[model samples]
Target chain A: MVEKTPILDTLTYVFLVLGILIVGFPIIYALIAASLPIEDVSKVPMPLIPGDYLLANFTTAWTKGNLGTQLINSFIMASGITIGKISVSLIGAFSIVYFDYRLRKIAFISVFCTLMLPVEVRILPTYEMAANLLGPIQSLVNVMHLNWLIDWFANYDIDISLNLSLLDTYPGLILPLVASATCTFLFRQFFLTIPEELCEAAKMDGASAMTFFRKILLPLSKTNIAALVVIEFVYGWNQYLWPLLITTNPKMMTAVIGLQNIIPQADDLPFWNVAMAGSLIVMLPPVLVVLLMQRWFVKGLVDPEK
Target chain B: MIKRSIFSNPYLPYLLILPQILVTLTFFYWPAFDGLINSMLVSDPFGNYSRFVWFKNFIALFTDFLYLKSIGITLMFSLATAITSMSLGLLIATLANRALKGKAIIRTMLIWPYAVAPAISGILWLFLLHPSYGVVALAIKKFLGVDWNPVLHGGDAMVMVIMASAWKEISYNFVFFIAGMQAIPKSLIEAAAMDGASPFRRFWNITLPLLSPTLFFLMVMNIIYSFFETFGVIHTMTQGGPGGSTNILVYKVYQDGFIGLNLGSSSAQSVVLMSIIIVVTILQFKYVEKKVQYTG
Candidate 1:
């Protein structure tokens, strides 16, 4: 806020350069290393500049590691999760904020509690859900003996059995994240700011509640929707622990999981260049999202309550 | 704050709310409930045929040496990450907050790394610090003549993880700190300067006090981040290696629950993490409540 002295100006530049160096060095180094052949990477005093085998390394990582398929899988999972989260949380926000509902406060409070209870804490049972896929629903059907009733329907020449699974699928990857507590909170906050007169005007026009929401609230919520989409998409793309735990098939693996899968976990040394190439690829989408839609990303993160 | 006006829809509101509620109940509440039950019900070493045993898992955790050490290491790691990242963030933020050339460029350069996933960041750092093939590690070896292997040394592993965690977090803290500082009224800063306050004096007197709210907010967020979100980092980098030196509470919960197959103990650890999160969340609400009261 004060007038900067020459010393301070130099210090500021120094700090900027230092910050950039500290932050960007590893990423750049990895990108550089990713380009080189394995022999070049293994040698002491590794090259700091770009290597000549960039295309070859990329192609190798793609063909051998199945990086292309993993990227597609990750895209599907991320977009699926993002859509699921936005839709569920948006309707939730719409319901609680615009409509008068009994136990609304209870619903809100429970959502808040869910914010505190991250999936990491409930990994064991959540893993159970992922493993069994439809265990909860199947058990419900069995407990209530809906199968006997299904047998009763079988007399009408319709067969129904209640066995299902979501293991190694997009729905499995996306379903558990549909209950996005943070997005709900952000949406609720956004909806509260919307002037009540919109709804009043809709009512004056004899608009039904659904129409009122569709025409009024939904349109007004474009910013919140965009912001939450970016945030949730990054979250979905960056999901490591859940997808890592659930997905066993290579065909089902996402890019992030694939990156780690390529890395060495035990005594043997790994293919460093290939691993680095995979990491660089894994980092692309989220970095691009934040860089491209930076305004919404920043606003969504820093000033959500505003 | 209740909405002043709302639609009256008895049926449609419930219909709208049902999807989110059902998802929340199934994924969040049901699993949490299962974890609660599993915590109290002790299972065999092989995790089969568990009978109800209240609080024993928690008791065993307290009595266990490694679990206690994990608590200490987690505290140290969280505090280290938060403080390191936040201080560096504050420093760089202050530097960039000045009327410097290429201000937008500097910020754009600094902020993009926040989008890098924690695990990816860990992998990058691991590549840099790897024993035999790492470029930086080789440079450090030649310059300082110290053997560098995080895979074998606990202290080195902790440092590596803290560095990786702090690296990703610095951009986040930088954003908030810059935003917090920018929100301060320039008139106050100028007034302090006009009153013959030096830049350092003005910063300590006015800017820092004004930034305390943001500081406190980031403190809570960073701590929670280190607890829950650093799973990817630990998983990729150390995997609680070098004899459980870098194992934080969250990772330990995973290590025990998923890898060790001690369902009761892992569930107990989850319950402990639950209480910890509850405390942090309450602290956040308390701060928000105080801010509300202050504003009112």
Candidate 2:
């Protein structure tokens, strides 16, 4: 900005325009392709302008691609992960920042260690664990040769080997995705910034920890909660690998996964129009979230202070 | 990090933290520990029996040609994606910082790509580059006379996945770069300008060095992104296909474990990836600590 010459200003505009075009081209192209008729979609050099079959393509994508059910599933998954992560993180952060427990440091370290193990790295075991919620315990029992102990307890008709699987379920889709170290750290950082006087004043009133947390801390965390909700919702909605692996039933798939189903096989004639429409349908929610909640989204992303 | 005036009720704090601790222990620790154990165990064809062969799986991976090739492919992919995304991000951020008008509009237009899921971005690119009917593919064939078939060509497939991955990531890098640029002191630039320094000279001398911390942070983040987060792109776009040309390590782990049913090899791959991530993360944290010290 300092001593900006005319040529430099012109070059700056040129580069910015080029950047926008490169960034926006795919979405714009998808928008145009989604509006095309079925026949024109496969034509070489697909049309650049919008077409009249927009509603028809959307209808085909909706019914044939099964996007309606999938969108609902995505909504449930996204909202579930958002609310669950925020609640647990708030309480987790509160405990770490407000209490003097002996195991506080250990708990923090354990939670922080989760950052090193992404879902992709441990896919098989995670799938196994989700197949049986008590799998680790079962493995421990087996490894320790505790089968005889279970058998001895079976004399009273006790079923010690309980099977609880979370597969093909909402909790399975949502819960594994909810253990976020970043959100807990974010809340911890925010809690550290709250003045000591507030806690002291609340203590002078002889208020319980829960009362102080509920009455003051929760209200104070509105902005942070809003920002985190935007980030987590987008994260949840955009999830692919976990949801794709967890949900075997087509009826339970997320919208993003549903887009794959609608794409014709490599051997089959590609239906570019319907596929693009499906892509648009899949991307709509998170894109809208980013655009509408732009402020909170930017804050959650770029601002470490949040 | 605790408050001076703190809650002393021990039971309530435990109750409060129980959900997160339980989830982390069950989901993260259990799975990670299971992967470590599984890496050492080889099972029969049927799910009948297994025996421990410690370090054998890792040795096999090192000796296997396909696994070695995959490691090379992963490094290349991560490096290419990180460089392409970060350079473009820096360029755009610098330009945007200089522009005086419509800055908000330019930003909104650019950052929406951050919201586009990697799988969806892959699908969009697939539409543009499908060999038979893609508009851009056809245009390239016409203008450049190059036979562009990603389905059959390994090199083309790599280019496609890299572009798709980088396309989705540029916005993230751009956001960080913009923040980094904004954080630079204006007086420094103004003083350079008053000394009759060219904009290029000032940028190269002062701005770039000052932005090194942000650049380093983005480099680590982008490497991690290309490593782990591009799973969806590779899955939907190439499926590690055309004779496994586009197979990154994360995708290979899934394919080998879930599809090939090679549990030991896949778990070993997972362990390898975990180490990679840990190293990169530690590097980033070190840089962050240094940055904090410089600022604080």
Q: Candidate 2's C-alpha lDDT? A: 0.88
Best by TM-score: 2
> Which residue pairs overlap in candidate 2's backbone?
none
lDDT of 1 by residue, A1-306 (tens): 367578877876787788778878888888888888877887777877778887787777777678888999989988998899888888888888876667888888887678756787788888777667566777678668777787786755333344456678887788887765888888888888888787777888899878877888788888777777787788889888888888889999988878776785557556778788878878889888878887777777888733
For candidate 1, what is the DockQ-based docking class?
medium
Q: Write the per-residue lDDT of candidate 2 for residues B84-146, one digit (tens) a residue.
A: 999999999999999899988888998888888999999999988899878878878999998
lDDT over C-alpha atoms for residue B249 of model 2: 92
Cα lDDT of model 1 by residue, B147-265, tens digit: 88898989889988998999999999998998888888889889888899988898898888878778888899899989888999998999898999999998998888877889999
Worst 10 residues of 2 chain A by lDDT: A153-162
Count of backbone collisions in candidate 1: 0
Residue runs of model 2 more than 4 Å from their true location after superposition:
A150-160, B291-296
User: How close is every model to the real structure, measured as TM-score?
Assistant: 0.93, 0.96
